[model samples]
Target chain A: MGLETSKDPFLTRVKQSEKDTFMQKSVAKAQDAQWDKREAARKELGHWQDWRNLGEQIRQHVIKYLPDYLEEFADNVEKRGGHVYFAKKDTDAVNYITNLAKEKHVQRVVKSKSMVTTEIDLDKALLKIPGMNLMETDLAEFILQEDDWDEPTHIVFPTLHKNRDQIREVFQKLGYEGDNDPTHMARFAREYLRRDFLQADMGITGCNFAIADSGLINLVTNEGNADLTMAIPKTQVVVMGMERLVPSLKEAEVLDNMLSRSAVGQKLTSYCSFSGEQVAGESDGPEDLHVVILDNGRSNALGTPFESVLQCIRCGACLNVCPIYRHIGGHGYGSIYPGPIGAVLSPVLDGYEKFGDLPFASSLCGACTETCPVKIPLHRLLIKHREVMMDKLKTDKAFNKAIMKGIGMGTGDPALFQMAMEFDHSATLPFVSKKPTSVENLYNHEGHITHAPSMAKGWTDVRDAPRPPKHTENFRRWYKDHEAQKGETTDGE
Target chain B: MKVVVFSTCVVDLFFPNVGAAMVEVLERFGCETAMPKKQICCGQPTFNSGYVADSQKTMRNEVDALLSVDADYIVGPSGSCVNMLHEFRMHLADDPEYGPKAEQLASKSYEFTQFLYRVLHVIDAGAELDAKATFHRSCHMTRLLGERVAPFVLLDHVKGLQMIPLPHIENCCGFGGLFSVKEPEISKLMVNEKVDDVVSTGADILIGADQTCLMNIGGRFSRRNLPIKVMHIAEVLNSNVDMSRVRYANEEELAAMAGGRD
Candidate 1:
């Protein structure tokens, strides 16, 4: 499920998500709760604008010299006796991780929360190995794992759609005698997953920031499962999106502070660890560490106008502010990278034709841009995707193309524009007359269209469309009357 | 000062009265207003939807028509449209002809309150309205155009008006031009939430600089028969004119519209 969670058409998937009232409520509640906290946290972390500018500068520097950084990072990893694999595609990344697991003959794999692993469909690839057993160490992931590998709905809180009762139900399957409470469920999960952690032969984690100077990978989490995952296993594999790197721990530290504030409104998560290969005398750490940097279409964005998308820190701040995401929820996007970041990043990775509707899913309200810790101009990038799909790819439907073409011609000529305005009301008169001319009743005689045509039924379903007022009822007519009465209108200067 | 008005296509056709109020408000500030008849749409509907090549044609026509006016400032009642005027430069950056004109015109183009507060330095337009009202901050106006301080400053000086802060006022009303129709379910949820936020403030009149937002949020308000009046910022500023509330949908009229029909 590498960002391709839904094969259904975009509208169909949107409809499915819209019908999920529980998910919608959950998203809205989470957003409201996080809004004030995020605001306060950013205010507390003084000079938020300066901090954002610094964060943006750091990311821009890393991305501007990404090739050099990658080379330096790989070399540093090699110096630490760790292997670095640059995977140009999802399959390339997946094969490398699974092949490594196979080489070790690792039977039990315990994982921390890693979206890049999900992007490469790593769990499926690893599970394909014969007799391999895997468990998600995070509590949310464990609940989803118990519920039959349910695809995560959010980047941070994957099991946001599940309630306390649902968690208890999933927990009961593993012989837990606890009430339907979060603390109770977490305690039971810890007891249950501890055995897997101790027995696990392989550990897989997603890198939040790959510090190039030190060859260390940073993992930030509220659950602390990541710390356990990195320390427990003899063999460990770190999956990272190629752009997730900083020059050193200094840059990583600034980002970690910002990420905590933007992600969950904390000063920091319960665990923010910078782990590298095991020291020679270390007692418990992976002797063999493999870091796989995945391109998976991210390289497609590196040199384009979309290069800013790689600056995203996966803080989920955009999702918290997204009004559209509040209604349709994360699953509405039908991608592993949900909400604003998903809209921008998905089309770049999955091509415009495959994910054309993803860009159009936004209201372009710019909330994501405002709340973004790294200031990724998420809405502008969404518009860029639309332009790429329509103007460059010429992938928009012919009907829409024709209408837009007509708009171009009509607006370009003042004569045609005035003519259209004069006749627009009459042209729409039949629809708005409400005389039961047709059973459809697209419009009411009150001059308001109650229902839009099928292509635009979404508008009419929620609100009424005003009939274009004829003659003096329009603004031009009102302006004419007001100006005539004033007798003071000027021509140019 | 000479002022050229960009009465957006939405106001020109559906809400023409707004254009009247805008002119009146501008005149009160000792500004002469010019209406460039060659104007039509701002090319936003097409540009936003990604028809860059076609939208550029409309944009070039607009940039040329707007440049024909000899005015000190170009103002529109809408921040979204005015911001698009600024964006015209970006759209035509590759074009040798319109690119420079786009920037020249965009530099002078301002949203109504933005023009009033920033250029004219007039906070109160010497008009009064007796009602509790809350202003909806259009996403483009506040976040895009960076016109936050102006609207609040002007709304402050309105006589006999109580300005109550809307809860989560920064949230969008879900009127993304085509987005209202393209993603209707999400659009409805957002507007309804906005309506709830508005009603919770106990304000009878909802004012905003952008009517695109007012249309979506107001349409839902009218449909729900919430008795909340929606007015463009221009109308609120032209308080002496005694204009009626912009009716999006008359519930009684829509209900009785089918009356006595077979």
Candidate 2:
């Protein structure tokens, strides 16, 4: 339940995901539905690019002075009668929160949807205490919790992989006799979470943006559960990735708009709360507040080429547009973060040794970059990751590196390239199918290679590759002949 | 205009017809075009796969070969390769010798449709094809080259061609050079989805600006035994041409289309 959701090889996970037609269909449906809504929401803003530029500038500025903002934020939280803890490691965060829970003698704890919490494996850590009962308040998180703590396939729609019938079956475990109607099931979940909300002695929520100037913790949610998590408990703890800090409430307000539109295609989330220490006379708010600012490999990206990755607001807009994510879903990444963001970030946060292949998972399509509200250049970052892996880290396999080198040497010399072009047709002749398939060999003059060996097998396995044109009939030769004919006519005229 | 044709490796070897069609189309527009023979590849095959050091030599070779012709503009049939040329300036930014050359090549380079509309000011290539066609917008063209309008505008001008909007045109065809080979499983699934969308458009022919996408999508169509003819945008623009029907953009319209370029 940490950064890695699976220990299986990437290709193995991809193979398993490819077989998940149901999950694939669900993800595609969600993406298609979100596309219209997200586009419409963006277009309604008018000058969306300017807005994006502003959002990007704000994020970049904050990231540039992250430490200063974090210092100001921690100071403000302290001034507001709140305890601030900066945990450099994920374990530091888990240990601190768990120890705090034990010291307070808390028996029940409830949580709202927070990717950082999932990232640090906090739920697993806290549940280890004896007699501890924890409830996930978000409906999707609750569904996952009820389903034996299944990993989220998406950052926003965690349970997107699960169908309504699956949700119904999962809910049936909690003694709900209702059918698979989403609203009814949601109602049943709300009622179930309401019981825990009243009794929960401790509540944990993730920060949307930590407003440094006011020391307010910004929480955005479609559901009001985060409010409940903050409102109902006597002890409150907020977990945030260190990069989630903004300069002020104004910036937070701007990002809140961008996040909601990009994440769920809404103008604003249903509940956008900026809360901190309970007032002296307040009756309902938490008396004790704890804020855990977690670095946990985030600093690995700071001052590096990957620094822009922290600019992400966890909108998951990249996932909705990524063709790779479309086919394989989240688990295919093997990291808690998936899609283009994950492809770039996982290697930085978790090192190339563990998450190197995530970069190659993308088709370098640039959809993620195009769709990013913050304009993170997700696809370019993916390529950067690959460059780092191959040139600096030397994490890629030797065979792959050798092939790339061979390609480089081959392409660098025109003679070698011409030779490759000339030889390709005859070399592939043995593999080319003699009997034509559906269409005549109109385009493929030398026939298509339906099957091949080594690297090309991957291509020929799925589709026939046209053999390079015969050397005598290649484009350059043909062009030279055509130009000669044109020259004859011009000279005669 | 004197233009140099940078026939990408894909077109030079595998799909020469695309390169040929591009030449014919350019000639039809009255632009003098010449092929720089040494411009063999764009280095995307190695560069995008993370072979930065290894690809530098290939990239340098390309910049040298492309700039050797000394033409008014350099153009390519494939947007993906053209975008790679655009990337060369940044990639070679540190190289004091070739940095300026790379930038010059990038500035002059354009994809076929972009060159036709933006540079040549021609909207109609006087092409006609009596069939339904859907265009698979290559990812590099739309996103990297920032050319979403050029291909569509030119396709709209192709007389007798019924253009249907391809469903989910924003998605990639999954031919990320080596990515196609490295992750064929995922690539297969993605390309299959593309094929489904192409079929959904109910078009007999699928056209695209990049041959790489066409090859991947067309390969899938053929592998699945779907008889959808795959074509480059140039081929569609070169088909059944009538010289008298060709049209060009007015000065104001051209200025607007080029974002105020005079």
Candidate 3:
């Protein structure tokens, strides 16, 4: 389950998520709350569009010269007594990291939240090693770990789907009896995580952005668990998506300002730490630093129309604004990555065979594009994915293609369109409601179309579609008659 | 001004009153309006569904029809359709024949309210509607066309109409053309949420710039027997008219309106 989080079909997952009213309510509440925070944060910074322009330029410049910067980053890291490994795929990343764990004879591993590691299925791979103990120190990730590794519904707030009661139940499994108060649960998790921090020999954390000029891993978290994870463990591994790097601290600082603001509406996360291989002068830092840059099919988007998708800072702002995500939740996407960004990225990383439906999940609302801090054009990329799948991949159904072909023919020729307009009322009248309804004024004929046959049943099932007026009363004919009357009035004048 | 009306297919068939209201409103502004009979759909049904090659034919037919008339401006009742014309430049940029024509079409085209407020310099349409209403800002119009200010300002000037600020006005109404049918379950959930927001407003009428959105949101309101009437912004502006109060932006007001999106 590298990228794929659930084996359930997309609709099945949607059906399951639909039953979780709590998740839906929570997602809505979180989105509305975050909307104010994010807007206020941007407003505080002033000239948000200009800042977004700067953020986009920095990401675009780095993406344009990605390979050169990666090499520079690797060289600088090596010079600082750090080992660098570029994993082309998830398996490669997992194998390299697991091998390093074996080489170090690691027994206890304390981890911080890293989506890249989850993307590569690193946790399960590490768990396979005999007597290896891994604990997720991030508050949300720890809650998910305790709940039998429930998949994350959101990027920033991983356990957002879980309520205080569910979290209390998860914490009770670790042998503590307490009320469902959030503070009590957090303290319980903190105490439990601190014990692991003292005993842990290795720490794994995700890099928010890797500074290339001066090789350093930047980690931003509201909780200071990442600092503790790096500080307590002798050996540390910093895993990152290959695109998560800037040319220098200057650019990283710009993005850090944006990421914190966009991600959680913070001026800066509680802990914005930059670290590398332990220096001789430093008393407390990792002695052995392993940097793993995982491509994991990110290169598939390179040189494609979708290359801009790599501009994502994983802010999950797209999800917060997405109507579809609000309804179906993250599991409905059936990928480790979800929402608008996931819709574009999952198919790129996984291919159309498994993730084809994700792109069409959106209404192409453009909210994601407007909200994106780095301006990924998430909605446009989703359309691009659809185009690739239907046109190039030829994965769409023949029936849909035939229907679309009919639409093309009907809309393309005015003669055909006129013929359809002539028959519109007569054609749909059969499905029009026989008895007048409360909203009878909405339809001039019997009533609104309460029921329809064929493909239109989808529309009729949920709502009453207005029946088209007769050809005699249609707009074109009406406009013609009105124009004639206007000519007469002008002549009289 | 001679304005060519792009009476979108939805308005031509399902909601012709919206087209009539738009034409009437334009006439009231003292502009000669012409509807290109050859114009039909904007090909969004197929284009957004990913039938790019097939949709191109429909798009080309639209560009040809909209350009058939010699007019100073081309305007439509639907911002969504207007945005489609704007995107014609992107879709047909490779075509040697229609590319320039598509660009020309985009340059002249405007959404109905946008044309009234921005192009014609309208500050008030002098229409009265004795009803409380909330506006649903359709996604394509507000976000894609970037015409957020026009509808609100024009609506604000509608005499005797008390407007309520809709909750989550930024959200889509789940009428993404083919998306409503292709993924109806998700669409249902989204529209249900939209209906709830409108219902919560306690407004008797729902007004939106795009008929497609009004069709979806109003259709659901009818289906639920909610008794909430829906009116397109064009119809709202073309309501009971008081020509004496009709006003246009003066030079100072024009400068203030300059900051609005193109």
Better of 1 and 2 by DockQ: 2
Give the TM-score of each candidate. 0.92, 0.98, 0.98
Model 2 Cα lDDT, one tens digit per residue, A1-493: 9999999999899999999999999999999999999999988877888999999999999999998999999999999899999999999999999999999999999999999999999999899899999999999999999999999999999998999999999999999998889999999999999999999999999999999998988999988999999998999999999999999988998999999999999999899998988987776678899999999999999998889999999999999998899989999999999988988888888888789889989888888988898999888888898898888878777887777778899999999988898888888878888556554323568477789887888998888888777888889888999999999999999
True contacts kept of each: 0.64, 0.80, 0.69
lDDT of 1 by residue, A1-493 (tens): 7778878887787788778888888888898999999999999989898999999999999999999999999999999999999999999988888888888999999999999888888888889999999998988888988998887888888988878998899889999888987888899999999999999999999999999999998999888899888998989999999999999999999999999999999999999998878988877678889999988898899889999999999999998988888887777788888899998988889886667788998889889998898889899999888888889989877877887788778877788888877887777655553422211111222466666665556777887666776854666667666677667544432
Model 1 residue B73 lDDT? Answer: 86
Each candidate's B-chain TM-score, in sequence, is: 0.90, 0.96, 0.98
DockQ scores of the candidates? 0.35, 0.75, 0.74
B96-200 per-residue lDDT for model 1 (tens digits)? 878889889888999898777766666456668899999899998788887777788678877788999998776889889888876786788789889899989
- Where does model 3 sit among the CAPRI classes? medium
Off by over 4 Å in 1: A433-446, A452-458, A480-484, A488-493, B241-262
Question: Candidate 2 residues B91-169, lDDT tens each?
Answer: 9998999999988988899988998888888888899999898998988888888888888889998888999999898
Positional deviation of A235 in candidate 3, in angstroms?
Answer: 0.9
- Clash pairs, model 2 backbone: none
